[model samples]
Target: MPDLLGRKFTANEPNRVYVGDMYLPACDRGGKNMYLATVIDAYSRKLAGYALADHMRVSLVIDALAHAHGVRGSLDGAIFHSDRGSVYTSQAFRNYCSSLGVRQPMGAVGTSADNALAESFNAL
Candidate 1:
């Protein structure tokens, strides 16, 4: 549980970071593969924030995080939790998080249960 607690504390930092992954359907306005957005608070059981896009590229993840931060504020030591999706694993997003002082922690690969917070949020 220490890891979870650490994530929370990291998120609570004055300008901490928050992270999550999103999945979009395989269809755009023109019927392309679209993914849904997924994000969560590392500390407050609150959903914190999220955004949607037609694509599941790293840009979508970055945009969602930007929306969350815009809603909440600065993110310094925020702990971002996510599955090992390529978008989340992308160098760009990881670099962005590092630049913002957010610790990027990937959920165990192939273990959706490990990210129950995100699963539960989606259900909500």
Candidate 2:
């Protein structure tokens, strides 16, 4: 299992932000258009990674996590936080988090403040 993520910012630009974007192609699944979402890191502002797929399933999130983990090893039980979405709640993501030994944390339902970090980064 991987460790947690560190809160320390080593780069000079500690306030910098990184952005990632997901674009789902046209596909028919459950009679709904697929969706995409990105997760970015603040500080060392860079497009760390992204994920795009036919559906906004939990697997996509796990794929993103794999990409991130591949680039940066071991989160050291760091806080893996996200909005309270169904995909985030899916077993795949949960299992992936468990395997990585990362703590899964979520914001309150319908509360923007909980995901302020992600939203703030997106706004930037």
Candidate 3:
């Protein structure tokens, strides 16, 4: 994967580009943390899809993207930009993206600015 997004986070229309990422929320009274994966449409800056799980595995991200596909009805030529995390870079995730005809672009290593949209969302 390459940084195809080139740090540009805007899109001309919905599903043209999507920025997504996974985060771990604050632990609850049970001291258990939940992982959340989110997809935001760049054009509208709205939440297109999301998935929460007990673990931040590849399936978490996959399910998030799948939700986007279901909602939008198609994701054949969308760009999915995210940080270079293992869940995003895993072979399984890559294959899932390919299956949906979604291109995966990664942010630079250790560079949070490269994925500002999804990062800012997680901060909310």
Q: Rate the local accuracy (lDDT) of all candidates.
A: 0.67, 0.58, 0.91
State the lDDT at 60 in candidate 2. 80
TM-score of each: 0.76, 0.65, 0.94
Q: Candidate 2: lDDT over CA atoms?
A: 0.58
RMSD of each: 3.9, 6.2, 1.2
TM-score between candidate 1 and the true structure: 0.76
Q: Candidate 1 at 110: error in angstroms?
A: 0.3
lDDT of 2 at 61: 76
Residue lDDT tens for model 3, 21-124: 89987755356778889999999999999998888789999999999999998899899999999999999999999999999999999999999999998998
- Write the candidate numbers in order of decreasing TM-score: 3, 1, 2
Evaluated at residue 86, the lDDT of candidate 3 is 94
Error of 3 at 123 (Å): 0.6
Candidate 1, 69-116: lDDT as tens digits: 788777776777777789888999888878767777766678776666
Best by lDDT: 3
lDDT of 2 by residue, 1-124 (tens): 1212232222344212222334455556778776556656545544455666667677787777677767666655545666677877778778877897766766667765656656555554
